[model samples]
Target chain A: MPLLAEGSFNLLSVDPGLVFWTVVTFTLVLLVLWRYAWKPIIEALDARNDKIEGDLKKSEDLRKEAEDLLKSYSDKIDSAKHEVNGMLEKARKDAEDLRNKILQTAQEDATIVKDRSKNDIEQAKVKAIREIQELSVDISLKLLGNVLNQDVNDEEHRKIVLRELEKLKSSN
Target chain B: MLSVMNSLALVFALTLAQAPANNQGQIVPLQKVESGVSAKETSVKEDGAEAASADVHESAESFDLNEVINHHLGDVRLRDFYIMGYNFPITKRVAMMWVAMTLLLVILIPAARSISRNAAKRPGRFTSMIEVFVTFIRQDVGENTMGHHSRSYEPFLLTLFFFILFCNLIGLIPPMGEIAVKAGELFGYQFHLEPGDIPLPLKIWSGITPTGDLSVTATLAITSFFIIQISGLVYQGIAYIKNIVPAGIPWIMWPILWPIEVLGQFTKPFALAIRLLANMTAGHMIILVFLGFIFQFQQLAIIPLSISISVAIYLLEIFVALLQAYIFVFLTALFIAGSQHRH
Candidate 1:
């Protein structure tokens, strides 16, 4: 039995001594590595990660500041546009008011000149009618004296003027 | 595709049939072992007879396929190496394991020191590659799988990956057994080797790769098993025992379900150990068997063909080495993760 057992390779069985050695070596190596290598290695990797994260955050902050500056500049531009629009509206209103005042003053002066011309024409017509009437009355008196060969007194002259005025009225 | 597979199946069957015939041809002692038979009479069979070529025929008849295959697959303690009169008996498995461990230390310890000194600087190319492996485990396996326990288990998972990867890759390097034999001779110690004759308990399946042996894989799996249980206990305290039977099962079913779940725990590690051992061992065996084809045929014409086929398998074995290492780490992380969440 021993001779046969010593010549074969049994795949299923375990050697306890080998297993013990394997565990011992594995544990020893693990302990040595954990102390000498793995701890610092993990720390260094974490530190690299932290550095990368910090850089990303700084860039993000700078980007946000630039956006804010851009927004403020746009706000200033918007306010300037509003002020220019207000000044343009006010200038347009003032020009409209000045034009209205000029038109109103021209209309008033035209009315005053038309009224004075109308009064002068009326006065001139009245004075010309009076002169014509006196001339006609004198001519009629001279003609009467020549034809009758008689001197006329004041009362007689007045009565003749009144009679002539009354005859003109009766005729109208 | 079915017909093609059928044809390959036929080809494979033909090779299988051819192997035994070739082996029989070498072992039958056809014209070489007759007592009192003259070399001239053996060589004079109505064909081209050369007395000098009878020795060639005798030499070719001794190649035993089973014995050669067994010697390559089987393990034993080779001759001991004596240094300053202190004899050290070294098996091929142990030597290969030492090589793997030494290689990992050489690469990782320096890279680790570089990072520790100036951590702010970016890693160089080789360091970056190592970082890729480390970060892959940290992020993909550890953090993604174990969550809170990721940081705690990172170093262990890293070590397991490097160890297994080195073992698998080192096994692919040829002539390791021959190298052990030569080392024994160099030390002026000659031990009688009964090749292919060592029995089960005395045999140490050797070439390279301790991972190819159950002793190594079982140890690794057992360690993982302990970690799994301990982490579960630590995280859940005594309540972790409640995880033995899943929630929502009836009280009546507890007896049946409890044993099954407990068995399931053990079976997982068993499978883990077997998967790695079988993969590494099978790859090495296939390469050895392919090379054995040259011996089985004993023809110079078939040597090139056998070598080319073995080279193709060699490339696949290299890919498997990396893949199996990743898989081992991945599964260990998965098991650790599973322990954290009981269900």
Candidate 2:
């Protein structure tokens, strides 16, 4: 049912009866409830809502911390890779240097052995050449003397002895 | 299949038969007309009146000893009462309102005492339900509207919201209707519960719904309007006038924007009054219509349909009870907020 005053612009026209009791009723009830109901109920409700909001804040903070940790691990992983590469490169360079030093030592040792053998051989050859040539002449002479006794021709024996004496002199 | 249709047919037949019964037993001044016809007249009048005045005059003829209550305050003859007199025959609503308040206190006082009786235990259904409602309004409506910015008004708003709720809820109870009408009755037995076979309005020997009374609603709305503006003025002082005219409007546009802005301020509170008055009044009319059927039919056979409609309406009225309360409080807050806040 439409309860409005029709065709009137008396914008504030209202049924006085409804208004008066509403105020009375409202006042009485408000007084009673203000004392008992309003305080505890509102307090409890605000407390409950505050608790829920607090929990939500904690969850958000935890989520942020987890993201930070995840970022740190990722950064650490990159740096670890760099450090390992640097160590690997240093190890490889040291290995190459050690190998070169070892090779140089072996070459120096080989050179020493070669020079000592050549020196020894040279000394031995210089001392032995004269004596060996003289010895060979004396031995040949003895052999020829034995052959002359058996069948020696005087002229060939003299020529052989003279050639042998000349050859020995030139060798000395 | 014929029976199902017949059953529906049976229901209609019963409704038609019962329709005349509610009207039959009803006594009217015009004897020759017979309730058969005169009752129809009352029904039509009641319906039209319902549609027109609705809850506005619901308590008018129902209030008894109304002059005595108003006499204490001095009614129309007294110039102040005449000019700004309280309407809605304040006696019964005031009394009933008292009763309801006492009842809530009675219920809550023992309840409060008992909360500590079971220390550490949460309150039970009634207590807890009251708690939940109080808390919801406190945080959602009260705090949100006023904020900590104005703690002074928080308690006031909270009070307004619940009081409106109690009035609305008490009005919904069928007995309270009779109680209200009974309180105003001059001739009939005060405690008669549905006296005759025909449904009867509480034989109010005289009076009306206080909230339905326009004078009362206007007083409320106007006072609230004053408070909204004055407080805005006090808080903002001379700047409150700014609410009547927008700050950034072009100088040439003052002619257009000024009136509208000014009218908006008054209308905000006007809407609150009408809204509260309307919601409260509308509920009674709905219940009356549903009850009118039983009297119109005169047959008991329509009980099923009547009961069905009544129950459905009652369930809906419960919501209206709370909704009207919230709307009243919200509008008050909105008007208050608008005036206080810039634009």
Candidate 3:
């Protein structure tokens, strides 16, 4: 056995010592492996998983932020259009009021000129009628005076001449 | 000469127990071994007819190393009751086996203690490495081998792989470091020391690879073989036996392929066991022999060649220690996987 211990090229055989040791070694190794090795491997994987999830969430948040910024920009554009429209409507209303005031003053001035022109025409017509009536009566009286060879200027003189003429005709 | 005689006698005593030898001296003459060379003559006598020399020659052409190796195991397996006898020495193998076990307990228990639930971070390097290996085995081998109950086998496979790895590594180291033993005991027989009792073999560094022995390897192979068969039987039953021959064989070819398939099953694991033993064992021996050649062939011209060869082989042996461990684990996984398959 001691000679055997001095390792020679021995052929394959079961050394009882070798078998016994193999079993004992196996048991001890199994125990260590259960506790130290497998447990840590699982833990590391789980940790890595958590880290990946957190990264995904951060990306989602950034995406949402981008979306919000886009929405705000669109809303600003919409309100600008509404504001422009309001200003245009106000300007149009102001222009319409100015036009209406000028029309009202023009109508009032036209009415006043028409009234003054009608009053002047009526006054002229009355003056002409009075002149014609006075001229006719003056001519008739002059003719009468020539034919009768009498001159009458006042009302009392005329009345006496007429009475004297009438008495002479009656005696004839 | 006395030492040679004793070695001869030791070898013979172990051989005759297996079978009876005829007048021609070949035991178990029923079958011819793979080589055509007949194992007829055990002893060599120099014949004048063969241009004989006085120096004894070990016949490489005729002898089988396998037979001689098995011969060393003796009658340990034959006895109904477990007894360690004069021919069989239990004391040596047992003591060493226990020492190996103790070493395992001492090393692993504390390493396990360091791992905890509150370990907010991962464990230390060794612990993390172990974890990675466990996960790999669990995913690759365990799930496939054990199915839904893979975790159950995880503990067993992981433990077995490391245990075997550790033992093989230990075998490669010199058991007793520089402390010289003036004398050593063999099966209660006190070996006398002439000042320095160490043999050239033991004094040199040898590590504890147990697969080097046939008995050790055979036992391991046989155990795996039985486990594989039993699992197959339970999982696939008679259909499992049918699948062992593979599906495409013509019914007419069944007779020939049948025995071969049975033999093949045993052969694969046998090869696994022997391969591990041979690779590690041969590497160690090559290194030993090379170093031995250094002094044994003391001529000046041979010195450089011997040292160079020995150094080269030594480097190769270091790689082998790791290689054997991988092979054993891989083969074990393969066998387990094959057995699990039904079709």
Candidate 4:
């Protein structure tokens, strides 16, 4: 090695004085700065970070709440629409039932009227036929009694008249 | 090791070669010291004279490579600066330590105030930058390394980082030692400055960086070493010492392993001190050497080359300044963490 200056100029040599001063300076800096600087700054930074995180979490919760509200609203609207459709279906079924009842009542009324008219007509026809048959029998009895001047209530004459009338009715 | 030996040989050869050219016609007055010698003491006295002459010869030269390297690496004495017939004796290392601390105060005091006052608001750019470093050290270095126990040590780690950072950066400012001497020589010739008529740098300070000094770095390492021990004690309590040996090691192997573990403890801090000292010293030495080359060769052709090389090294030194500071703090955290957690 190139020779070094003998006194107070060695690179490896430690000055006790310097060491003492450095320790003092370093210790003082640590103490003063710890109290003044690092503690407050770190606390503030942590607080800010915590605040930011809290805000983010709060926003997330609010978003979830809104989403839930929206879901419920849509569900309400869906159920209302379903209820309206059900009501409309029930109304349509009611109208259809009313129309069927009216048609059934009209058909029954027409059938009952037509049957009564037919029964009335058939009764009138039966009465007219009975009158005609009674008149024919009376005329025949009167003419026979007046012309012959005999007893009209006799059994042989009445039997003959009735038998003739029966033959006539069969031929007609 | 071989390379170091080889480089020493080269330096010796260069010094031997430069001595003759530098000392061509210079003669020392040996008669002044040769008078008071007995016969038995004559040889010893002559040897002393020879040694003194050698020292004179070495000092008389413009610059030697090793001398410049050592000069750059060595501590500055407070004796270099004196005021009004009073000598305030302290090493430049301590003075530079004070400078670094002062710079820290200048930067951090305002930053701390701003951070506190505007706790809710977003920080400004400068405040944000400082916050980034503070948070990084607290969370990344402190928490990541020491976990829950990191809270107690973050301030110390921050101090260490900024202190060494400032020291290294301030050291890289080419020590105005030679320039100041030249300026004083020029002033001596041109005019005289009476008491209190000089600048502070000229009167009160020498251009020295503290982190480059071994004593400062050693103190730091020693402090870190103690902190490591204290942290271990705090976290591990009475069981701290038991952490040194591997848990599953055979009882017989404890004798072998214990010394290694203990040695590891001292070596860690020792390595820390040396790493910082050597890094800061080497960067300064490279810059000094490059600048010294221009003078050593005294050639017009080497001027630009030396300037360019010195500039390059200076840039690298800047990077080294910041990097070495980070490495020192990072390793200190790692060491403290290691001590606490053991495995």
Candidate 5:
């Protein structure tokens, strides 16, 4: 083939100088890039990946904390609502008891006052009737003396009047 | 898009159908034309393509596809560098390797600094872009293949990957020689360099793919081979020799299996070198071949089709360049991993 002909270019020909240079170039590149390029770059990539994973874990933890806080706050609010309801119920019951006690005391005082007033009326009526009966007996004795009627005694007259009044109160 | 496809199909059919017959007719003339060009280069070093009418017609009639393909794929010796009483001949590929090296240092050193500086913060676009490649080699290629031992081999793998990748990508760009020639034409001058007469500037700026050269790839594969063997020895000690053959085979089979297993070790790297060299070289060769069709047919009608196909192949070449770099490192990692274990 013309491609492999003598003095013509051979694609497979090995040039030792080129090989040497390639080796030198590649070795230098590997060393230099490893120090300045590949090492730090790779480290940075790892750091970034780690940072990402860490951030995700941190956020996850924060979300869980927030949920816990929410739950606790809701629980607190529920308890406060329950306490307020209990306080209201206790206040209403206490007010009802106080009202019932006040009504009982007022009714007792009113009954005592009414009974005392009835006794006062009964005493005044009996005293005033006794006084009037004695005054009528005195007038009858003075008129009998003037018209030939002799004075009757006070004790007998009072006794007769009280007995007759008692008979009349009973008959009426 | 359909027309482009149709035109490409027509070109492929025509070339495939007529290539052998056409080769039979033109082979002698093609060789003659190659010799003529060389003779012309030597005789008329300064005057560019000032030929007789008959010679022009002959040159037009014969275009050697092999010469064009080889010219692109083969290495050109630029000059000899004498250092410490030793002569080191610098080829285009050697210079390109240096270019790739310089490029890696220029682009990556700062990226490394930036990464180290802002390791906690999100990196900039450029730094992050480089980090993606470095991380891919470390994690995807290195860690996946070698597992925990990947860390130890990362620097080598990363260097191998970026170096080869840069070389492959740089190859796709138009070489300084071609660009210089075109620039010379625009200025009404022709830039022609006799073999070994490349200017210092042109030599420095030569843009060939180092990985496409067998010598370079062989060097890389040789390094990988050593690393693999050493890793095997380091992990398994001197017993690595015995471990090359799988365990549980009959003791009687040892005599037959040992040599083949050893040979398999060498062949793995051999395949790596050739695979890289061929893949990198073939893409450029195919592109040149497609473009060569235009001159071969000597018709304006072939230009569009040839260019379109070349463009398509060129795009595929870009993908192939990255893929081949990835494959080289990945396989090296696999080989290294394989050596570290018995089965």
Candidate 6:
């Protein structure tokens, strides 16, 4: 009680000076902080938010574009595979037709060569028989003439020998 | 946690230092009473005689708890500033407000620079921490309460929050006066002084909460009141005057309801001022009262109980300091928002 009386202190006593100082101090703090601190910080926060949102949207678009490209590439690969299969099928059919044509031509040439050689052998045999018969008629006429003292005709003997040889070939 | 420990140490040291000075004034009568009682006991040592002496002793020892509480809570006029032929008294609370203002400027200006520099990048730890508090004040308190209009008022709200917060937090730390006294005592220099005898340099960095002062809180509340009223007038125009009574009331009841509703506007800020003042003062009062118990009972057994309870209350005071600052700003924002709209 003595200290309170001596200091003249009261809990609810109003002090106008303290209030004036507080107002001045608070106003200064508000002005300094508002100018240097709050404005820039809020702007930065908004900017960072916008940048993040834009980056997210850009990434989403890139992902969709990549997906589209992948689908188109896969479609191209599928068509190429189909074209390759068709080309193989056509090549195989062409090779088969060429092979059949070559085999048929070879068989025909072998048959023709065999028939021509058979005809040549038959003509050669007929000429050789006709020449042998003519020679024999000349030698027999000469021997008979020497025994009976007379000559025989060569043309009629040759003709009669060729005819006999032909008859013999036909009969064989 | 270290600051809290330092604060506890300081509080204990302050109690120990003040104890002797306090005893010099208070314990002399107690000693005289004891001698008288002992002299009586030597002649006739009866139970009734001892009880009567104990009652007499209690009366003789004058430890005024109200005086101590008031002396600490009340503002001390440090000096007078003369301007324009008028004197403005500078008190301890005013100096404390200057301290809070200095701290705000010193700490927040650099933080603001860092934030602006790092707007496109991540900020440093300290800057980011400051940003977190600023963001909370803007987004949670200002934006949540006032919506888009909060942008214009964010500066005022932020200043109020930080200013009150610094004042409250600074009060929790032992005042420069106590620290100086304790430091002097540690070096064998003793000071036996009253609350007013504390020197100006030591007194300027006040340990007392400015918000604990009714004048200071009232000033802040008055500011908030103006902002609320101005916002109402600006947003709602002249209709704001009529809108205070709310809509859909009977026209006959306007005379009755209008006066009470008009008074409600003043009472809202009045409650705000008182709420902050009481909350800030109560914690310190409880702590002081608990510490006062040691001297009152003059028992060693009560020291541990008193100090432990004081420490508990001191910790609670820290929490209340933040909570009260938050509550003051949040309510102001709410009131401003409320005023701008009808109902």
> Each prediction's DockQ?
0.15, 0.12, 0.09, 0.18, 0.34, 0.35
Error of 3 at B287 (Å): 0.8
Of the two candidates 2 and 6, the one with more favorable DockQ, higher being better, is: 6
TM-score of 4: 0.67
Please provide, for model 1 over A1-172, each residue's C-alpha lDDT reduced to its tens digit, 9 standing for 90 to 100. 1212222244666655456557766776677667666777788888988988998998899999999999999999999999999999999989888888888888888887888888888888877865666566666666666666665435678577868876997899
TM-score of chain B of each: 0.72, 0.62, 0.62, 0.73, 0.82, 0.83
Instruction: Give candidates' CA RMSD values in order.
Output: 10.2, 12.5, 16.9, 11.0, 6.8, 7.8
The residue-level lDDT of candidate 2 at B36 comes to: 19
Clashes of each: 6, 46, 19, 0, 1, 0
Off by over 4 Å in 5: A1-9, A47-85, A114-154, B1-37, B40-59, B82-87, B188-196, B299-301
- Positional deviation of B171 in candidate 3, in angstroms? 2.4
Interface RMSD of candidate 3?
9.5
Off by over 4 Å in 3: A1-9, A13-172, B1-99, B116-120, B140-150, B177-207, B299-305
Off by over 4 Å in 1: A1-10, A81-172, B1-58, B65-89, B174-207, B299-301
lDDT of 3 by residue, A106-136 (tens): 7777777777777677777767754554454
lDDT of 6 by residue, B28-79 (tens): 2212212222332233333344434455345325455654564466565667
Candidate 6 lDDT for residue B213? 83
By TM-score, rank the candidates, best first. 5, 6, 4, 1, 3, 2
Q: Chain A of candidate 5 scores what in TM-score?
A: 0.71
Candidate 2 has a TM-score of 0.51
Residue by residue across B11-122, what tens digits does model 3's lDDT show?
3222222222211233221111111122223232122234233222212233333333232222112111243633333332333333455565565545444544433455
Q: On residues B1-343, what C-alpha lDDT tens digit does candidate 5 reach at each position?
A: 5345434433433343233223322223222223323442334333323433235444545456665555556566656677787767777788888888899999999999999898989889999899889889988998898888899899889999999999988787656544454356568664444432444554665556788878889999999999999999999999999999998999999999999999999999999999999998887777777777766767889888877787788778789999999999999999999999998
Better of 1 and 2 by lDDT: 1
lDDT of 4 by residue, B145-166 (tens): 8888788889999989888888
